[model samples]
Target: MHNFLRFFPVFASTLGVVLAVPLNVSHTTISPAPSPTCTEATTTALPPEQDCFYVPPNGWETKEPGAVLRHRFAPQQPFATDTVNYPAWNILYRTTDSNGDPTYAVTTAFAPKDISTPHAMVSFQFNYNSADVNESPSYGIYHDIKPKLWISKYLQHGWFVNLPDFEGPLAAFGAGHMAGYATLDSVRATLKMSQIIGMPRGADQGVRYAMYGYSGGAFATGWAAELQPTYAPDLHFEAAGLGGLFPNGTATLEKLSKLQMSNWAWSSNLRSVMIGLGTMHKKIREVITSSLGKPEWDWNTVIRRLPQEKEVSRLDLKNAVNTAINSPLVRNVLDYDTTLGSHGIPTMPLMFHRADTDQLSAPEDTQELKNVYCNSGASVFLHVHPNTWDDPHFREGLQACLSEDIQTFLATAFARRLYPGCGTDNRPWGDHQYGPIGAR
Candidate 1:
């Protein structure tokens, strides 16, 4: 039932950069490494020259978005050195930023070994919430121990799986427009790369594709789906599987600020969001640092861990908090422009899922997104777990259930059929027998 290309092997190589830094004796300051090495990717047949994986080669920058700047034949050999890697190509491609300025992004493209299953490509956006480009999926999957390990399950199924580093070069983590642009360009580049590589011959043109992500991942997918019609009309994305989508950073920040210290356990995620904001807007860094000055609540620690939302809520520093909130940098950076209905509606089917009760984030985030898209004439199926409400522990279970549902919907979507269509949220959560919840 499966095709085995015994001849194709993935050779492991360093990604050339690291996200974490080593500290000196004081344990207070981080010192950059003495030498930053250029990572050179390689396989059994071809070897990539040493250079920053993202930097474009000569003349590649002049091309349009989706043009392949460079590529490396590297495979994810996580467990051991000799284990066979599912054939994949790490690609750097030209794309645009939120401002429509030329930039570059990266993606990892792969397909079924069998290559004869009426091929479709599923661009799975990786939710890497950091300010470092080295932390992108293509680089982290090969280097970091915790880069969305669940994507491995996709390899077992026979389809093209493309993972895009939606955060552009500056690592503007929360800029939805940039995320969307990079994702669309990743698909564009992959279409061309697929044909040149000849994995599933002719997969380069007119192939129906699906998009998927959760939380930060959904940021990219959500924007891409919204921007597709106006920005990249040629893409045929039949369906998008989105979950835990927080479209506006300002809304999330306001919610966290209002919560009391009793709900501080989820504050670390707030810190992570702040890190993303800081990456995109440098002017807010000092204000943010002062706001998060407490021990154990520092930006760096909370970035690595979770913070207490009550402490971060700033009820005590009323005037100062208000000033920070109203600052130009904060307003400009967290602006919900080009998100959801602000642009154009997605013509494709959308499976939007949200947790009934999440202490770290508001359920209204997804609900609001659904409302806007639906009002704009987009076909959307919203899934809310009736039974899972108020259970903090259900987060993991919720994601797993959503992942399964997305895959199930993709089966129908790729067949050129609309997935259960709009207003179809009767499907049962986790059980799959028509209960409640809809992840596109």
Candidate 2:
């Protein structure tokens, strides 16, 4: 593994940011609109803000979770390749929210033209890192080239790729259970609609599924893994690759508040998190307003708006972050909702990796989670990258994408192999089931 690190390409450039443009989109249900007609000219056209495909039909809640509500041939966006060879579809499905209430979400499925029998499937979560529904991969995937390239790699391997907007329609970004439900339901929708999405017959049963996510994406993946045992017991994952895992919400906010002075970007991220969390938990809004006194702005309305809106002043952002961190009521809600590892240990094997010096998510938190899983008898392989750069958070994330370690881990898991060369100086700890190579 160390030898592979030297060959990884340097990705010093930052990812492209999706410009936030406010739109008049509604999350509530409306009268059903006609189905979309997918002509060659309309295939590449972006979905309008009021695209009826997103609106759940009346009585949609009566359907079971993971039931396909609507689906359309999606635009081959973020990639200018031939749609015939790499077809994609947008699926709106019924899923539960953080409160376990019936809700709806969307996911994009990409597949190779000729899928092999008993092929592999990868649920690749993208790190959109925003609290805006417009920034979701289903709509804004065309803005970033990195996610497109990653999706293409999986397609090149003849694996179906499922990209879920795990934040749901409300864009409740930091709500762990909601993200988990959406992620798992997206997979369910893909498998349930296998034939509709052009998969070979009986493909669902023979498909070997794995998941990969980094940074904010990892937050969703981690939560889904933890919640899969009870929340979605019908589903099973061959392996899960979680890099730069966000373990504790409170700890993360405290770390960001301390670093916000040096990097204004960190302050922006702090504000986004607060808004994301506030969307799902009313306690967060109540505590912030009570601790800081009623602000000139309406907390309820503000939480519904986009995070990048200038309506929120810098002073308000600072005060909200401080109140969220200090107030016991807000902290309790965050501890229960935003944190990972409290739910349950995943049954599938996990490949965990992170930089030794990640600024956003502390290294100790990842190690602590690994300890919890290992102690619970779960198969886990923990890899710690060397802190060679100033911004290990970004550099290590790029390394995860550039290196073949994740692919190798998934392949080993798909093959039901016990060891995938996980033991080394860099990877000092793994569960007994996946012991060090050559230790049998």
Candidate 3:
């Protein structure tokens, strides 16, 4: 989730910004696109101007979100049936105001493309916004770009992609539970949009609705899956996939300070810790005020107070928690017995992929998640990679594995009661009841 590589130039005594260009071609081969009716479907009542959508007052359909605003270049290959990869008339909208809660918008490459019925729809949970001022160029590389890439791939399969700005009005980072609800509602809004447009979404027939996310996405996915059974029971989802899960935020703070990735992790952890402490514990407000020499704090105010590298070096996280514990504002919640207090249970199937060598998120902690839901009797699969450290977070391989596994699992998990390929041996994967392989 954290990119430690950004700091390399500081030690090398050179200063320059390096642009990351995606591979000229995607390495992972994708499935072919399905045919659609010749008649074009139309978009329904458009969302207000502020929201992200297909037909905003001004929008670009070809470029992905977080991309440098620039002229579009034609893709070398043609989309199926000569459909434009970046259609000229399609609209891309952004919605921030959803009454009071935080919300964001997303539109596909071809909004009005013909699809009589959709097989699945995926809504993404965006990570934190590190950029200081709204509309200013992002200070850090925009990591929320993955969802756009994923949406491109899903569109090839005729599935709709939904992107949600989970940060609400204040852009709440580390507010895991609230982020979850916002993500779910965004999906609901998309479904409502589909209905309004007369597009058929197989949500009632249990159309395979899968939730896929990485890191910040993982947190949103975890909370969404946990809350869906109760919150959005009418919406049918087959599976939920998560990778680079920073699930136990409290535990992660305790473990990651000494890791090689600490340089990057510290910033995210500090932001999340402060936000979580402030949002979850009422008493924490008083302590932070007394210790930091401030009268009150808001999201932006607290984020600005975050320590720089040198100051953070002198501070210890566990000790900080102790101080927070004594703070009149956070004492009660901090003193509350367990790390992850009893929360809602997840009703749908779950797929978690983790690499053994992950520095940002421990694989062991991820494996333990299966045990948490084992009693509920839901279908769960835990895929463990052989400690690959390709990504700074040690999660790139794990993210791919989770994506592939979830795709295969949902295709077969419910109807056939079958699991996809799994295990180090590369043998066939069986249902949860049978495990990946049978020795007999």
Candidate 4:
């Protein structure tokens, strides 16, 4: 809305060229209706077999609620799953990196119970994975344990779900933003697989789509929404829901480095900063000195090995890890200001939720986004939770705030009706914003 970037329709074909991802397509026979083919411009061919739309085979015995198969989003490197009832499959797939290195992703098809209903698809990306850099260790474990708690609420009402391991195969730091590309592609893959599975293709032709995520997953979902209109015009999206959002990577990194007094958070913050630095800055290690440093390892090493550690506290944060992020050079490189609205914000309805108690992510992160969006003549409804405090931590509170409402909101948004629901701190903050109790 701030006109941060020019709006350009990104047909799937154009994105394939820009990303250099070759496309392929194929067919399978397990579906209830004929699947759809790529109607949008696309350079990549659909995979040769509809099974390319993976569904995990063994662990999840297919159910009659019309559950299609999906491999556990993440199990290990070089992971895979198989197709089930729908000709489409679900999988944690792999593709070549820019350097031809294999990268893994969690990809799957849209499976609806009552195959006859015109079900829309939604992808709910899970938050950061402290364990693996490329794999969504968090999503993998959560999905395995709770198949679709959040999404099931939607599928029960006639919606398909396509969750992706956006961290690529490496689960690297800034991979959060890149997860958007993976989500869009996986969505594209879903659209194709739905067609291959022989599900009612036209049932969802121009069907409404919505994306929602919190924390790390929020980063991916925001990016995907930002990229969708231009990157995959053929795949229509109705709206996007982003909660506990981080608009400027650099800003969050700076705040974390200066707040080292906080124990549990500082290490993870440093870890994220290291990942961001690894992704964006090249002169990091050279700017860091070995002595008088709080970082655990030289800048280069931390970036390379983040995924190997199961926990951050055990990773020796007293060393170079802390110093690296607070390093003037690293901060200088990250100081560049930016916002989600800098790119074209989503074209459809937008819902952004932030917590007042969130010290890890400054309130200004979402505030600046609202300013950019509203100023751009875009209509966005901002929701802030006063119960969310600055110092106490807001992740758990945020999850409790909307796990169920998000599903309901998606259903209503797709239905083009006002969403009826209740949440803590639902009162408005000002003209259109919500929250800022102490600030008020």
Candidate 4 ranges beyond 4 A from true positions: 1-88, 91-104, 115-118, 131-139, 142-148, 196-199, 203-206, 258-260, 276-339, 388-403, 418-425, 428-440
Residues 351-406 of candidate 4: C-alpha lDDT, one tens digit per residue: 77666656557777677777776666554666665553333334332343324556
Tens-place lDDT digits, model 3, residues 162-270: 5554543333445555556666765665555554433455537433456777666677788778767766676667667776676666556555444313444444445
lDDT of each: 0.60, 0.71, 0.44, 0.49
Q: Give per-residue CA lDDT, model 1, range 186-272, as digits (tens).
A: 999998886654545442544668898766787789899988998899887878887666666666566555542334322333444
- Candidates, ranked, TM-score: 2, 1, 4, 3
Using lDDT, give the best candidate's number. 2
- Best-matching candidate per TM-score: 2
Question: Which candidate would rank higher by lDDT, 1 or 4?
Answer: 1
Which ranges in model 3 have alpha carbons more than 4 Å from their true place? 1-118, 129-144, 195-198, 202-207, 259-262, 276-283, 289-300, 307-322, 325-341, 388-392, 397-406, 410-440
Q: Using alpha carbons, what is the TM-score of model 2?
A: 0.84
TM-score, candidate 4, is 0.63
Ten-residue region with minimum lDDT total, candidate 1? 21-30
C-alpha RMSD values across all candidates: 8.7, 5.5, 11.7, 14.8
Window of ten residues with lowest summed lDDT in model 4: 21-30
Residue 323 accuracy (lDDT) in model 2: 70
